[model samples]
Target: MAERRPRREPRGLGWDGREFEVTVGPVAHGGHCVARHEGRVVFVRHSLPGERVVVRVTEDRHPGFCRADAVEVLEASPARVERPCPFSGPGKCGGCDWQHVDVAEQHRLKADVVREQLVRLGRLDAADPVVAGLVVEELPGGALRWRSRARFAVDRDGAPGLRRHRSHDVVVLPDCPITVEPAARAVLGRDWSGAGAVDVAVDSAGVVTTTRLDRRGRPTATRVLRPGADVPEEPAGRAERRAGGRDWEVEGTGFWQVHPAAADALVAAVGEFAQVRPGETVLDLYAGAGLFGGALAPAVGAEGRVVCVEADPGACAAADANLADLPQAEVWQGEVDAEGLGELLAELGSGPDVVVLDPPRAGAGRDVSRLLAGTGARAVVYVACDPASLGRDVAAFAEGGYRLAGVRGFDAFPMTQHVECVALLVSTAR
Candidate 1:
């Protein structure tokens, strides 16, 4: 006999199917703004602050609040705009949240959310000028077609699409304008039935490679697809990128900035903030493909030492090849937590003059920040993708006697709620 499947019990706050009009309040952290209906807190999406809208509750599983999407705007905000993507809506593609808002207003909303998260969760001062004057700057193309990389889910029917909000159901995406031309051509209108998912990336040379992952989540094959060509079945291997005035070769599936201008922008920002000089010892933690490490090598000069630590073996190998020109640069493979970082520092026998860490979305945790604080580095440049995680780690850094010196936000993922941040911290004892 087949094993019995466990039944799912109904869970809700008694407001699941409710519909009501709400006056949207300030923007919250996760692509939504807070509002109240009949004294019950509501988190509404697809709406802007100061707008009066009628919403349909999408989720009410949690106590005290229900999640909703604005169905009809009785009084629309000035920033409201016609959503460009047909897939974006109340129950459609969940990829782009702020597509309904004007591009400029989306920046403002993201900036507001970043500031609020830092101040509220990180306990950063609201009166701080840098925190208060935070703004999300756009890239070269403004907001359209900036993504050089995109991943799509494969539905049971073998169609490549994006998942719906809070769901595993794939929303068919025949076209996505936000992706770079190469990536857009690779997956859109393609049938990926043989794979569980597909990742498409466009290198600086404009070559688009698509990697199809099997149902077991292993890469079945990867191939370079010509514009409007069908997906190929052979591995194309590595791709080259030019950034920080140097050449970098990474695996077709490696972690590189998805935005066209992100690598240069971040390298410049970190250099300006950290100000690494000749003879300085620099540490690049979580250094993928040596983007930051390569940039710092020239600044630190022949007399200086630049060490790049990466947990991924493939990324470390890529970093090694990318920074081969710099005699002073070295790559160490390991995690970036207290134990891993501590052992590496001991091996170096001296502390770094400047440290740059670009950890994953779950920003370098408390233990990592605490370890970094004791390293005696004069400056630490942190590149964060999630504000909440950054805020939490910033608080942890404070406990290690480091202070938040400066932070800059970027609207890298336009139309989406994600924002990139580069933070500079200084040791109080330095």
Candidate 2:
């Protein structure tokens, strides 16, 4: 007689049609692993792939895929560590996913995630170079205090907190471990957000500006002056302190790289690859506070123009204020899509010599890809946050007539499994 399969049982995370005994095990990655009744498909998260656990039904449906949240662990994995945060285990903050797993394992899992995205979403050949990942053991300068900007929601009492992952409900945080030091200090010390956005920036002078606030999804032409870094003459200090490349204040509400040193390293890498020439025109897409613009303007000289494409009015204003001294530098207050870019480029008449794109996590679409391909620019430097997106766009560039020249990586968020990459490409000859 054939061996009998285990009997099926109901669980927490939902299952629509596919029914099987939920087997939990510790997977090689951090999360739990669950085997479905079919035995062919395995669901993984907080359980090891081999260990057994009773999974809660989160969502059920499709033929092969079912969503579940694990509730009970009948068997345990050796790798499991008692999670440190009350917000992470059993309870849910939803902000962090890998806190329960060992820190080293988190890196491995994140690497796998990136690798899978590259193969699955990017559609890269299996033989392509395996991109490596870095883990941040601690935030440099200080792990918990490195973040320079913070975006806090205003509750009714005028206190600030973060919204839930999917919902608008405010999560009142008595303590936020991930936020940078100065910004966190400014946030907790006072009642800043009054139904509006609040930003606290400390300039290089060690003075704090708590008054300038930014409200958009990203900090556009605006500044949030908090009780930190005070600007002498607003953004004008950037010109005055050009020797040290003075720090312009960024309010806690707007967008700025959480990791400052790492961002500097990445931008420096882009600068090195761009090999910008004086008297040449350049374009910065998705320019944030003109980090590229600020860095490249002097290299391009007063004669060269650095056109910035920024959608946020606040950021545009900030860019304008930051680059005010450069007569050749200008800001186009519009999106970086095909038509917008085309119009913005049309104003230049001639094609750009150097095109730098620091797109968000999603990466640029085909229209922008095609324009860069056909623009006849000598070189294009792309700075990307997500590796999968970078690889996809790199492949797209090859299809569009740009030959991939070289690529480099920067371990921006150490201890965390995030990597920042800069890629250089030269427009191929017709």
Candidate 3:
């Protein structure tokens, strides 16, 4: 018998610079809805589900699917709305994917993506009641004026803007409504030749800091513009945030949620899911700026202990200072994978009763899940920014005797495809 050979992918059909009328299908994971034209699958952006639209294929000759943007909405869905931002359309600012979609409808689509990923990638059956009806709750004012952070791409002309979808060409943005007060006003309608990109972080106090990066993405300058102050060309460090009844000092370039309400909402969700009690050991892995640490420490009480492990030295340093008030909380300034959870657990001299996993966009890999399972934590809360990654990790956790007990998604990121999820997992062996 002849050995079976690997199937070869079909050669892509050229459809670039072409226009076609197509009916949009259900929302896919990447903020685009699926559609087909002449037996070829096309990923249509700037379109809503069930909308009949004319799409201009921007990319073809790709291995699996072609990319296109809605050139015209011939028949719009009831969920469609005039995009609030003029920069959000075909070939325009790629920063926002669903500006054309209604805010409520956007949450529905995101929830659909979450459910789909859990079913498909996580190998959870649709018949499983737990995986069937996922809902994405919107943070207070999630739709507009919620983004506390935005990084503007700089073009050759020195204008700070967003890049066009699938292109490096920057779209000059004059105004963006989704961003909170000063950062939006400071960044939009600005030009800077000194940097390839600019990072704008607005703290909880509404203080704006802009970091100018050179063409190589190195920070050349940092400046702070207090609220009501004129937008400075350069920016400086540390913005203070009050969350979980404590102050958090996060650096300008440090990792924090983009939405203004994300910190509070996530902290609440994590706290509720963790169910940490007095005198219980808690672990916060990939602890950025110790946001979860702040909440866990108080919940665990002085008798209990909270350990935060973070890799970014700058963020770790900031975490050290942020968690200083809570003597029960300890910060480990090293990689979670490199330091190894086993070593940390041994050093701490006990297993955690509750664990919070907030890894990067890539998600905590299988090795991390295995280690987490070995930790013997009764409860684990996982915070994720990407559904696909979360779904993959969910399966990994399953393999390690952890079952997804509950999941809640939040529209922390409004206009973009990104969604935040807080999942509760319980150890089956326990």
**In terms of lDDT, which candidate is strongest?**
1
Between candidates 1 and 3, name the one with more favorable TM-score.
1
Q: Count clashing residue pairs in model 3.
A: 5
Q: What pairs collide in candidate 3?
A: 222-235, 222-236, 223-234, 223-235, 223-236
Q: Number of the top candidate by TM-score?
A: 1
lDDT of every model, 2 decimals: 0.88, 0.61, 0.87
Candidate 3's displacement at residue 291, Å, is 1.0
In model 1, the clashing pairs are none
| Better model by TM-score: candidate 1 vs candidate 2 | 1
TM-score for all models, in order of appearance: 0.95, 0.71, 0.94
What are the per-residue Cα lDDT tens digits for candidate 3 across 252-319? 75688888778889999998899889999999999989999878888788899999999888899899
Off by over 4 Å in 1: 1-11, 226-233
Model 3 alpha-carbon drift over 4 Å, by segment: 1-11, 231-237
TM-score of model 1 vs. true structure:
0.95
Model 1 residue 391 lDDT score = 91
**Any idea what lDDT model 2 has?**
0.61
Residue-level lDDT tens digits of model 1 in 324-391: 98999999999888888889989989989999999999889988888888887999999999999989
Model 1: lDDT equals 0.88
